[model samples]
Target chain A: MKKTKHKILDMLLKHPDIHLSGQKICDVLGCSRTAVWKHIKELESEGFKIEAIQKKGYRLLSTPNELSEARILVGLKTKELGQHLIYFDSIGSTQKETQHLAEDGAPHGTLVITSHQMTGRGRLGRTWSMPKGKGIAMSLILRPKLSINRIPQLTLIAAVAVYKAITEVTGIQTDIKWPNDILVMGKKIVGILTEMQTEGTNVKAVIIGMGMNINANKNDFPEEIRHVATSLKTLTGKEHDMSLIVQTILFYFEELYLRYLEEGFSVIKWMWESHAVSIGKRINARLFNGKVLTGLAKGIDEEGALLLEDDQGSIHKIYSADIEIE
Target chain B: MKKTKHKILDMLLKHPDIHLSGQKICDVLGCSRTAVWKHIKELESEGFKIEAIQKKGYRLLSTPNELSEARILVGLKTKELGQHLIYFDSIGSTQKETQHLAEDGAPHGTLVITSHQMTGRGRLGRTWSMPKGKGIAMSLILRPKLSINRIPQLTLIAAVAVYKAITEVTGIQTDIKWPNDILVMGKKIVGILTEMQTEGTNVKAVIIGMGMNINANKNDFPEEIRHVATSLKTLTGKEHDMSLIVQTILFYFEELYLRYLEEGFSVIKWMWESHAVSIGKRINARLFNGKVLTGLAKGIDEEGALLLEDDQGSIHKIYSADIEIE
Candidate 1:
């Protein structure tokens, strides 16, 4: 946080591949060798892994880590998504962080990521397990000029992007699970969390928090979740490129998001239908009102709610509920 | 925050009329006079004013003359609203505090109030002035079961509640300046800043930051803001009770919120229309695309968007824009 340390950081970041000698750094910083060592110690504390050789110099090594600011910024290379990234090694939740960031005037495209979240949560504050370094947990901040009715489409767009990104990078054949999750072979591979800040008729910010099971082994999941949860490495038998996948997600997202703003949902409606799990299948949507409608999954309505037609021909627009394939 | 302090608070709330001596408080709390003195000093630091005489002993005088924690919770009785009110004498902003709290899983109804805001803001990050002891600057944490589409209504409901509370308590008869401001006699008196923390589809918490000019004088307003901003005392020519106004706002909100859940927009729509400066007026809406549409206000749609009917009878829903009365 001091000026000398900030100068050292600037030097390292500017010359990513350069090695700086302790003598040179100490002389340039006008500090003792102990002070230079302390500055490096501070950088290490910030999750920058640097190797100090006796004769050669200090070489900055990019470590494969979770919730490291450098790692997140390295992966996220969009004008919007990477502008600001906040990382927490163990947080209550990433969605909560992004929401807080949005509230504090963190502009559209601010990102929050966390790994090894002790109290990670899902919808309705349900426990969201985030094993150490086994998944890519990230959230995106977006301030769009959108009305309330058009907000649900953001979920659909995110689901589509995640599914596309995972499939493109890992070849996992992901499917849209409606409203919020991504599935592969009847098991959830990814979960999306969307939180918003609104004022009157305008959306203050919409944060899209995503959790993807990337490198977790079967043992990584708890016994209760082993049946319903899966990882990219577990599915594919090899580690997929996380940075590449992140890039593809941001790229596809920017495209989809722009389309969503300029042209509405038609651009990706057919794509979503193709990747969706229950398009033509008979499914039972358990409504919160205690009404169970066993119907064929027709398609998504213009407002992004799932449209289901029953055997008797009554069309039901389900806003939010547990979706079960029968 | 300490056990004995909470005990004293409980005693004060339970017995508001009677005064308690230090010895009696010591007896009630099972502590020594020195311990009571230490606790009193700690409470004083937290802004709880206590009177101690040579023979009369100690009596809880006024809450530390602060909008901070002590005074915020003194007479506060709420099942939800401000159940956990954190007062900051001077903060970057209450929205920032609430955001941090939300990220740390602050309870759904947690409230943050600041005596003076260093970085108070309005919609789209505009500046909002918050001078000490002259305004009620607070933010409430709420978790609404909104699908992003219904999120905007919360602001309108808050605006209506603010208008009603200001007029009823201060007798100012303030007019709703559409969307989020309350104006008294064509001068701005209150500004509502609603910020939310949300992820993909789940809303974690919305911090409703409101800055209401309470006892500000004419000289208190900055030269630039003098023409625009006015306080309750400035309009009423006398200082008004802030606690009464706070209670009134919360009461109206609870009622309007209940009615909103039961009957939807119909409950508060007319109320907003009655106090608003938008309906049936000729206004020019400055669109983000640099296009301005001059139209007569029809009313708000179901999703709380401004419904504008042009002279040609074309209905347009204005989402985000600056509407000026022409």
Candidate 2:
């Protein structure tokens, strides 16, 4: 957002009920009254309902329904994360966009977000579709100086971050499904896909893509996933602001990510295990090699690999798999 | 190379000592005599010397000193490693190009080769410069269905392949330096870097980039690395054919890569250990996190991590590090 526009929005938001005169806005912003009126007009065009009176000046009635760079950044509380945000109305995949940005030497905490993704991506080459303006599809680019083996731990860290953000915003707790999903009552409310680009064992970038069904109704999802997916609005019977959710997630992500960097994966591993839904449950893991291992989920190892105790009481560290509670 | 050009080159290379008439070339290629003459002219322009007799035929005198697509493919014995090739006279970096190709759905074993690299890359953000027309810079894209943890093994496998190829071609055996470099008599001659793009522990594509100082002299290298770097021409006191070495390397790469997919890393691990110079030697390994551990280098484990036994006799698994023999 431009500096003057952000200042105007801040003043109007600070006092939502009162109208500030154009001369007062001009004095606060140190600009002409014509420039103040022009900024007001611009904000109105972006879906902000502004009431204009002959003597009472302008009152900001409501904000835009859509997400904008200004909207996500107005109250964002991060030092570096999301400071260099690239917002999109619609895109093929935020993950791909972040990958390209990372390749082009994007900063550490750059965020690429879209209101709608035409071709969303999920873990292991699965298709993820989200309704326009009803879901949050965002990819955060991180350049952590860690070994390649530790890259998987970032997924668990992200799951924990999203879990906390959603719970804090809605006052409704959500269960993290092992590595990447957030489940509400056995239905998936969020999906997280972490992709990495590495050179030999040196990591170039890690892009964490998260998609949450924020305001979608029962019929908004595709038929196949409708029975298995739930939304915050569907569960809470109200519309939740997506920009706030994005800001909260970014806030929590910065916090946990900094903690992981300073301390290690120990703190993150404990938090992940605490929120994981698959811990201590009887589950069947379909391994990448087309073999299924039926066992009891014994939580993740230090490296974030799922530890499964098979029927023979032997523990196997499953690196990549699709697990289901049996 | 175009189809007809490849066919013409193959015919000429088959009978290098004798002359083949344009009429015979036309009949074999199913093209016109004028077309055959045009191909001969094209070959001549690419540095192939041909002697045209009055009535007899055309005799192939010598091949090009520079690399060409037709030259490399003529006697190549690989199944699919270099079957689909993207050749360049000079490129920025074959690794970067191959990464882009992999993103665009390049098939497994797609090879990208360049006679020269403007900006060659070494592991851990090092610059690798090669003299024009004197080195081999190639990147191969492989889509292996393996867990992400196993991706590091591909670098060790590539080292073994390059070791075998150089020994077979130049008859001067080289030493595999733990993970990436191939050294001959305490000097670096070849470097291999394996990079990967992954989605949440699932391997998307692994690009194995190999850069070899094939025919460079001492003065061709930069002043800082001149004493530390040696090439095939410097070691053997004769110029080795670059195309023949490339073909040999690709042949061995395909054989060993297929064996890895079929059997496992056991075979490749054994091969790598046998040729490694760091095994059983006292070394200082500078890890990625800036801590240097001085230890005796044991052989690599099953997953290709270097097993280092420190002064206290405690063994540590070194995943990504630079080792210096003490």
Candidate 3:
């Protein structure tokens, strides 16, 4: 199958520093020499330069640099999360494509990633800083059989996944702010945008859009965002391995996803509570309509709304907003 | 402006009673006969058929069907509700198009109505029947500057508007069941599907997709749905004016919408409480996880969740599911 072939090539691609002979490649692949040669030839024709001299055997000289089906399959780790990856080298926005895919019945765990985004987006209609090959800008197309009431759990799950992945791979102490933002040293490093389709309270599909600053630098961020935006490389003082982080986060995400389906929010909510910063702090949440609610930031309620306990002991459950810890 | 020309032609199409000469049309339009003639010709090219004679000048033929900008403009009434009406005649789904537009900074209240949908949908990814020209299948795009907590108000407003419009035009006593479905004598007559875009709780835009059965007969109902769903004609024994109902609903909807922005849910909640069948009734709400809650259907809580009072007098708030009154 195409999936098996891509996996073999992906395993080879993962270790670019190593070289393998035809017998060794065939033994690991558990396939014949002719099939391996054919795959190597196919990879080279597709831009991957595989050195295939008679004695020298096979060595990965180069791989076709594309966000195409072949490359994404080879790059992705999870069995389901990004198994059916729909990647575009340059797109208007990955969120737009993911929405379309969900409408067209893309499986729950399918993902849409783009290398460059001409019309990239961030929270609150802000433009996302999306230079090609600098970050992971992808949208997970999920057909979660959940009520619209539990939709906020999608944001919480994504915040936890991205935070853990960044920390595990880049050694950056990234912290998730209340609802969605991921911050490193009090500067924003990742953003989560979620959209859902519902009829009344029945949720049809949920699109979890996550854009993480993987390799972008200080100059890449806009002047207005310079004071608050930071990247993984900027914080770690090196270019983090995007592949390893992608694998780890998606693996963790799928595990969390299964827990969400089986155990409901108990797992995700507990993990989010542990990962999040401002659980019991004094905070001011600024709503979209210019109204402000100042209270002690209590834990999230059962429905995912933040419970803010005011000085009068009245707890105002905030559904969605930008929160500032005072 | 382009809008003026569209307005003139649209007025003629919907008014079957109105007839005018080229000179009369020119006078009413405040334009030269040549300019009026040019717009009419453009309408003809776009699909509108205009009957032309020497004295019996520019009578819009009843059958000159077109999705011409002029036709849509003539039908739209509100200042903001349909300030920009995009008609595709046939699309994958109007909801998809409107979502794309909303993402691209299309002003809120931009309506997308199609005559036919290749992939029309209902809640929970169900296949909604959208036959060409027989039903009112359209998506109204709204950009309400309200928190995610207040977003559920749109569904309540839409359900009330749909219920009122159906009653006003057809004399049918429709009840708004909990959440958003419009039912006539215990069978669903209209369905409202609300999709939202949010960054945490700040709502960027909400698309309200309504699929109302207008002229379909009992035979038009799918075999599986024959027992549960009924159309306006099937129930009332008369075909109702869809456009008239759309206009009336929009007019009322705008009032309530403005009220919602100014006063929140105080007045609207009272209206919802008046017609709500579940209020004070014993009901069983089937949740997503196969758990059922049997309780008295109290009113909605401050955060828009349905309050269910158990036999023990403890209140359990239900969000997101179908409630069957036991």
Candidate 4:
């Protein structure tokens, strides 16, 4: 089905400078030449410009900035992450699909990406607006063999990954707002939500949902979020290639994830603190129980919990809270 | 559906000492008398003996020892737990069904019960043998607003609940083997597996799977587990009613869950320690990293972690391990 088409497109993109013959594609994919021709026609309908010469084969001229599986897999240099990608033209939520797939034994590094989310979800049961073909709505399935107590460090690790990806891809310098929000020029550009399945102290799987505004303009956001939300297009006044961004994120994520698995969370903590905006600043943290504590935002502890220094110079380890910089 | 049939049987069991007329049953259920008669015939074919007197009514004379929803819900007095029950003649695993139902927004206290589990699962990916119609294979879905760190306590709380239930139902003295195993006469009788869906620090749902060996004779167990596993019938030399055991477990579980929610884990800790068999004994703990540590089991800490005091008097907080009493 679509998998074969993706394989064909992957082969074509693997050698973007040269043309791939239909006979070779048919041989590699174990399909007939007619089927490859049909797939090429389908790809053309999806805004992929392919140049076909007489007996020379087909060359991928240009790919529209779509989050298609083939486009994302073009230059994805990760060894495991994003190797098994599930792309959806539209979906309810990537988190929901990833949960179902994880329950059905989806392996580690399996990715669920959607061009649009009807009901995009955030932390604390909040909803985020994700227009079609405008944002990166994805969920990665991670099976980390770590104790459940150390699960909170995953959010910080993901924040660092996203920060590094954005900087490396788009040359955008973003500040991580405590746990997982990436803010550009004091506006939220990305949100990371980490969920896990645990049996007692054993962590079976971790699904990290990341929503980043990539190509949305100022008018794409709703009136309520216009002042607080910014996208790459709005920040740079140009449309960026989303597939490249996804590929770069996967690359950086796979590296950091492997590093974290090998050598604890020290590197992640250091990277996160280097880009943390609230550290050394006065802030107010709203606890989950409706109590707000005003303090100076010190760096995080060993377990990635925020350290807040109150007026008495005592440090409070804030486990779960919403921070507001003052 | 089987739900309606269970409702009819529930009506019959609600007034076991008296006869229920067909006219009254039809009036209550909003069904025709013919349908009621058909349901009664079906129940009879399923091993339920209903004595129908001429022109008088129908009386439940006796019921086969089966884990039917009607049997389990007959005298259940829980407020929330087991209010919404999904019964199956057989299932692969109640935990699988409960996990799916929880993801689909099943409310708290939803129960998934089966007459048998084709593939009964245990902690750390182990498999348990659950024969058809001989064990209580059930999973309860709990949505508790607690932090992820407090989740490990659920296994201990459920252990205490099951211990109380077994003691009250059969008057058998059982011992809690620290985290989740319930042992009787130095043999395992019950195993509890608690799993959860967590986002950052917020716990969305907790699926508690409990498998108790009930009504199985000595010959019912396999040769491999004969020395390690024991059942209620094997211990008391008499068959026990399993529906009553399930009802009692639900009663105790709901009470303890609510208490843990309001009063914290102090009460649960005391009850768990009172029945814990490993405390004050020398034991060997096999860690997840293939390392074994032998020490004196010196009770659990505040977070329900096993505190192993080694020969050198240094205490080790064992997070994830398999304990073997030496």
Candidate 5:
């Protein structure tokens, strides 16, 4: 049902300058003229401004702030990433849906995205909550031909990609926290979660989930996290176009991802460290086993582990921990 | 259908010396006496010997040399490893099925075993072939509280468990190969493949697959692998009970796995080194990137990576490689 609508919309959105006739839409979509008319009416009902003429056909005048495959695909210039996008109005977790898709042989660069996440999740079993139509909740499926040890590098790559996208889209400065948190004004604005499915040392699939607080007000966050969470609208004092932001992020992510595949993590590592907030700073890391160590953050190693120099002047590799800047 | 048969067989196998009445079986299984009699006839046709006394009920006389859930569970002594067992006569791959089960929330220590594997696989995209009904193909699911870097040690632990089980069952000495193979008299006898599912640094589940050649004749193997592969029947002069071997392996695996959880991989590392075939010998290791190096095998490190001392006396850690004894 929605597939035909999306196809018709794609034709209309691609050539917004010229009107696409109903006959042409039917011919391209292999449907009846009545079906095309019905789809155009439905698109209009969904806040799409479509101008329909007697014989000139349909012209896409404007699109709603809503996310659609047609809207995203029209502006997305990636070769493969975002080429196959699955959009939802609301979903439990894009990560879970993308994992299932990857297991069922979803291609590399397949993206699952939603406007709202009811059961959003973060690293270490944390819950992520966002208001409806106020953020970008997405999971990208990657099938890289790499070993399990090198998978942690992808999370850092995602951090760099999102950092570039955020800075480019809004011209706002942001810092990438050690593992996978993007901060604005010392408050988190985005979170990235990386999950992997592997067979022995061979990697089968990796799901990179990103949840951002884009247009939400500061009060939109839960009371407990209000002090620590900030959104783009709050930082910029205005609401940014969500579709434009999503498209810009996908563009930069595809660029960095392809570069990482051809070369290695060296370039991405440099980018990540340059945008990192904790590098060369005094910090306290709460390890996964409930142990805390205060050290000077010396940056990341080749394997993506945090290199921490303690008071005793010995460097320690920190794998998974929560960092606090001192 | 098989579940009812397994339950009835479990009741009979648990008390082999006592006769179970038809009414008692019907009452316990929540079925009619006709159903019970039908299941008993089916079991009998499947090679289970039962003596029907006109007045005293049905008595089990003996069992066949076959693999069944009840047959293995009756003699199995484990806390939770084999407490939940899924048995099959033939399957594509036990590893695949066990991975699905683990994803669907199959508990830790869940075991998926089959009599044959049509599409068995080894490390680095290698195919493992075995004769029907003449080998042990099983996958165990484990949910541990460890990071992904420490997962390679589970492969070594599985090797040690299988080593102890084979030595205790057949009194046939075997040597542990570097990563996950068992060699008897310089011939490959067992292959273990350890796979993991993880979210960032948290471990979700690890599936350890063991495929062993038990009772196949030398000719049962394909022409390509016959020179490199050997069965228990070829090593010893007779066929071994597949059920007994399964029970013994599960027993030792549960013990060692629990110990690994409480303590670290240190104990398993020492045990593995004691039985390793390449520990103190000169060996050629073909690395993953098509490089070969000749070095002295100087045991394993705490993380289960093979340590090799080169001719220049520098010790190199071998993560994943094909080792050949020189």
Candidate 6:
């Protein structure tokens, strides 16, 4: 369907700031010049500005900030991650679609990205708001050969990778709140929800859903979470390019995932500790069973479990819990 | 589709030795007498011998030992398990279909059963053969509010439940092989593969696939597994009714599952220890990573984790491994 347009766009992106002849594109893509013109017009309608000179062919001026499949695949320099991506103008949830795809044996690194999520989900089955064209609602399918017990480490690794991408791309100092939350200026800017399909101890596939408030303004957040949630636009007062941010995240994710596979979680653990905001801070963790324990957040252990030291000098390994800082 | 036939068969089984008039059967099922007669003919075609008395109506003389939905549901006594059963004459894999059903919000205890599986899967992605009309290939859907770490306990619990069902129904002595295999006379009789869909620590659904060689003969198994696998028919020199076995397994599963929910895994642990064949014996555990460790298998802990004492007296918590007694 849109694959031909993506192929043409890929050619233009490969040689950025240079004019590409329609005849050359038609020859390479094995399509007629009229087909190339139609695809270019379609791309233009989807927010891509293609500059056409009198006889100098066409040039790509700028790509829209929308997380389109063609835009995300422009310069996606990954071996497997984000290799086969599914883009939606609006969807209920990328997580739901990715789960189906994973069940159908979609290859590793298959990604589902949507411009708007009508029903976004957060950790612990919480509702997350993703305004249209304001945030990145994406889910990545990963098939890691790891035991079920070591799955928590993946959340930490993903948090670290996303944090690094945010800092490198937007130059924003984002901190990770243990497990899977990225915060900026003491407010949450990103939320990650990880789901898995397992056969006993063998993990078949892991779907990591990440919702980041990329171009959202302060008013975009709901009334209740407005005080506690923030976005990249609100923090920087500028609209960031989502395609660039998505590319950066995918790049970092592939690198970190490969490194984690080769060297294990030690490196990821170290990196996660460097950006963690709750370490050495007094906090109250409300566990899944509705029990709250006040403790000092003493950093994560080798398996990426939070080591919380209570007042009685006893340390508890918190697996899944909501934390509140004091 | 087959609901009407199943309903008619249910009525016939309810009044086993009594002759029910066609008008009465039609009135009870809200169908015409012609429809009732057609359904009886269909049931007869499926290997049921219904003696037609001149004016007294129809009497059930005998029933073929087929694992049909109506036969399995005839005397099913359970709160939740097997309340909804999907029967298939033959299928590629019951687990695959059950996973799809579970993803589509199939309720707890929904059962997917097939008379044969063209490509049955064993633990660790091994192949399991199930000949047509010779064994029971079924998958049960469960949505338990348990953590991912405790999922291994469910596999152990299922093994115990199935072992009890096999012993009670067939009066055959079977021993539980560590995680999910039933052995009789040192030959495998049943295999259980438990899979889960989870989000962080919350379990969405657990699909337990159990393939038991109920009425298979010696030649029904493949050449490779023929020596290692034995069926009830091969052991007892007589065919066993699969519907009775299926009903018994579901009944025991519901009882044990409810008990597990109310009392935790202690009772299941004790029962599993009582039937375990490897405990207190020297065994070789082949882990997923291709590591073979020979150790003395102690009884399971409260969480149903195998305690394997190595040569150094160091105990290793065996989460998932294929055990072979020495």
User: Interface RMSD (Å) of model 1?
Assistant: 3.0
lDDT of 4 by residue, B1-326 (tens): 23667778988987989889999899998899899999899989877899998688899998876665677776688998998888888999898788888877899999998868898889988997876788888999999888788888989988988999889989998999978899998888899999999888789999999998998877888889999898988899887878788889999989998999999998899888989999999999998889999999999987999999999999999878899899
Tens-digit per-residue lDDT, A252-281, candidate 1: 888788888888888778778888998899
Q: Rate the local accuracy (lDDT) of all candidates.
A: 0.75, 0.88, 0.76, 0.88, 0.87, 0.87
Top of the candidates by TM-score: 4
The sequence of per-residue lDDT tens digits that candidate 5 reaches over residues A1-326 is 23788788778777979999998888878999888888888888767899988878789998876655556766577887777888888889887778767756689989999988899888877889888878889999888888787889999998988888888879998999989899997999999999898866668888999999998998888899988899999998988767777888888888888899899989998999999999999999999789999989999999899999999999999989999999
Per-candidate DockQ values are 0.39, 0.59, 0.42, 0.68, 0.43, 0.56
Model 6: per-residue lDDT, tens digit, B1-326?
A: 33677787877877888998998888888999899899899888877889888678887887777776777876788877988888898999899889888866799999999887898898867888977789989999999988777877888888888888888877998999988889998999999999999887579899999999988889878888887899999999887778888898889888888899899988888888998999999999998789998899998887677899999999998887888999
By DockQ, the candidates rank as 4, 2, 6, 5, 3, 1
lDDT of 1: 0.75
How much lDDT does candidate 2 score? 0.88
Model 5 Cα RMSD, Å?
4.2
Q: Model 1 off-target regions past 4 Å?
A: A1-92, A105-118, A259-263, B1-72, B198-203, B277-281, B287-290, B295-309, B313-320
- Model 2 is docked with a DockQ of 0.59
DockQ of 4: 0.68
Q: Whose DockQ is greatest here?
A: 4
Worst 10 residues of 6 chain A by lDDT: A66-75
Per-residue CA lDDT of model 3 for A32-95, tens digit only, reads 9888878777777656677666765766776543334576566566778987777676788898
Question: For residues B109-228, what per-residue lDDT tens digits would candidate 3 score against the true structure?
Answer: 788876566787877667778556667678888988775656777888888887777778688888888787888888887788888765555566789988877777888767888888
- For candidate 1 chain A, the 10 contiguous residues with the lowest summed lDDT are A63-72
